[model samples]
Target: MTEKYRERVCNGYDHVLTIDERLYDVRTDHQHLLIFKNRAFGRVLALDGVIQTTEADEFIYHEMMVHVPVLAHGSVRRVLILGGGDGATLREVLRHRTIQQAILVEIDPSVIDLCRQYLPNHSMGAFDDPRATIVLDDGLHFLQTTHERFDLILTDSTDPDGPAEMLFSRPYYAACKASLAPGGVLVTQNGVAFLQLDEVRSSARHFNALFRDWHFFTAAVPTYAGGIMAFGWASDNPELRQQEATTLQRRFSQTGMTTRYYTPEIHRNAFALPQYILDAIGKTSP
Candidate 1:
């Protein structure tokens, strides 16, 4: 039998992965979803012909996304996650004992249901945690209508295209800003800076206009297909991004949590952007 493969083309680059076994493939109401097993990445989930997450390196993305803000803010009791239906982000957030509530807003219920069935390890029972509240609604709508403010908000949306296009817009960002509590922080998935510099640039422009402090941080997730992935950081408290390594270490230690990729040193250094990325985002410093 011939080997089966799947390819994703983005920003004029093509990334191909061999499919060891096909688990599920269907068109949900929102988008086309596929799940398969790969020799190296374990289980891989793709939506609309783009790889969303893989078991192998998801820790890198999820940890950086959840921990960096949580540990930096140092007193995040309530968290709102937008579009992380896969539940890994929720799992990471629930690890913090300080977190009292974690509300996840997802547009597509099928993504959450199917991910729970097919990508069980990705969530690792996060959906069942008492602290987790799953809301099946569009993120923008939830942000606009909800009066509850969160200490931290993480937008784990897919790339700025298709069903997720509106998530990267200025209006969506403004809604997220409005939903945050005082001293809160907002982080967004800005895609890979090498190929998706425009996404970073757009978010940077919006963040700059909306907040007293704004920057982008980089992390390398192998399955994301580009060189370095950038996460948009925005907050009125500039000092949250400027926490000393020792302070971060202290906060992390108090949580009694173990992380694979996110450390105090890594957290501090992730903010240091390369020259090209800095130029693209129109910032001299991260």
Candidate 2:
């Protein structure tokens, strides 16, 4: 039999992975969902022809996204996560003993259900935690209407296209900013900087206008098909992004959490951007 393969083409880059087994393939009301097993990545999930997450390196992305802001704030009691239906982000947030509530707003219920069933390790029973509140609504609507405020907000949505196009807009970012408590921080999955420079540039512009401090951080996820992935960071408190490594280490130690890819050193260094990337995002420095 011929080998099966899947190719993800984005921003002039093509990433092809061999499919060792076909698990689930369906078109939900909102988007197409595909899950397959690969020799290198274990279980792979793709939404709307874009690679969302894989078992091998999910820790890298999820840990950096969740821990950086949470640990930096050092007193985050409430967290709001938008569009992380896969639950990895929630899992990371719930690891912090300081977190009292974690509300996840996802537009499509199918993504949550199917991901829980098919990508069980991605969530690892996070959906069943008592501290977790799952809301089946559009993120922007939830942000606009919710009275609750969070110490940290994470936008784990897909790329800026199709169902998620509005998420990367200025209004959506403004809504997220409004939903934050004082000293709160907002982090977004801003796509890979090498190919998706415009996405970072747009978010940077919005953050510049909205927050007292704004910057981008870098992480390398093998399946994301770009040189380095950038996470958008914005906050009214500039000091949150300037925490000393010792302070972050103290906060991390108190949580008693073990991470694979995230450390105080890594968190501190992620903010150091290359000149080309800084130029692309229209910033000279962090």
Candidate 3:
């Protein structure tokens, strides 16, 4: 009993000590955020009450969030991010080098402070990049107020609760739609396609109503249960898929890089809905 009490995680999520000495369970937001400390993967991340990620797993989340939609848009010069405090998203967005500017609007500044202090690898030099600007505010409010448009907008958010709820609303979708450049693309975490399937379908439908070329997709991360996760992409026009002339090369070559998941072709397959998702899309009430 003493051993169990000593080692057991206080949070509801199922995380065991990876290095025991390195990464330790700290606390939880109950059904939401599971706070942990690690020698890797950085700190202050929320896993959906299942598995937690290691340092290596964080790369998949960062890559998928920043890459797929941006590449689909053909060229992303100016970018906007909502709620990605871990800086993993910021790190990946900086890769193409063509990005003139990137704006990261995160509600809780503490999250960034934690990750920056503990998870330096996750963010690289994103916080110091001259082209990247970090704003501390509610993202939904930013969408409502910011008049300037972007080539890509990536929503890096928590589960559909707490501060992230409004980010999934139809009004928010409409606001984001209005706040984009003509050929801009938007991508968001739509929650798990397995458990939150209904919510995912509903959110996709609202996005579809707001944008012309829309797709729902998935990526796997070991920390995010079964290493499975979901995302939705939307754009103003179908031309995004046709590929426009861009200064940066659109195709991704894995010939040298170490990526556990996500590739150019994988981007296309991620949108292939499971049979249930196809049926539930229009039926789900927003």
Ranked by TM-score, top first: 1, 2, 3
Clashing pairs in 1: none
Candidate 3 residue lDDT tens string, 1-286: 1111112123343444333233334443323334554454434354444332346577777788877777776667999999888788888888767789999998777667766766678888898999999998888889889998998888888767667889889988888888889888888887667766766877877977888777677786655652358887788777665543231134454223445566766666666666666676753311
* Candidate 3 residue 200 C-alpha distance from true site, Å: 0.8
Estimate the TM-score for candidate 2.
Answer: 0.97
| Ten residues in sequence with the least summed lDDT for candidate 2 | 2-11
Error of 2 at 234 (Å): 0.3
Model 2: colliding residue pairs: none
- Candidate 2 at residue 53, lDDT? 95
Q: Tens digit of lDDT per residue, candidate 2, span 1-286?
A: 6456555556456788888888999999999999999999999999988889999999999999999999889899999999999999999999988789999999889889988998999999999999999999888889999999999999999998877888999899999999999999999999888888889889988998899998989899998886899999999999999999899999889889989999999999999999987887676773
Candidate 3 deviant stretches above 4 angstroms: 1-44, 47-54, 242-250, 253-260, 282-286
Ranking by lDDT: 2, 1, 3
> What TM-score does structure 3 among the candidates reach?
0.80
Candidate 1, residues 76-97, lDDT tens digits: the string is 9999999999999999999898
Candidate 2 residue runs with Cα over 4 Å from true position: 1-3
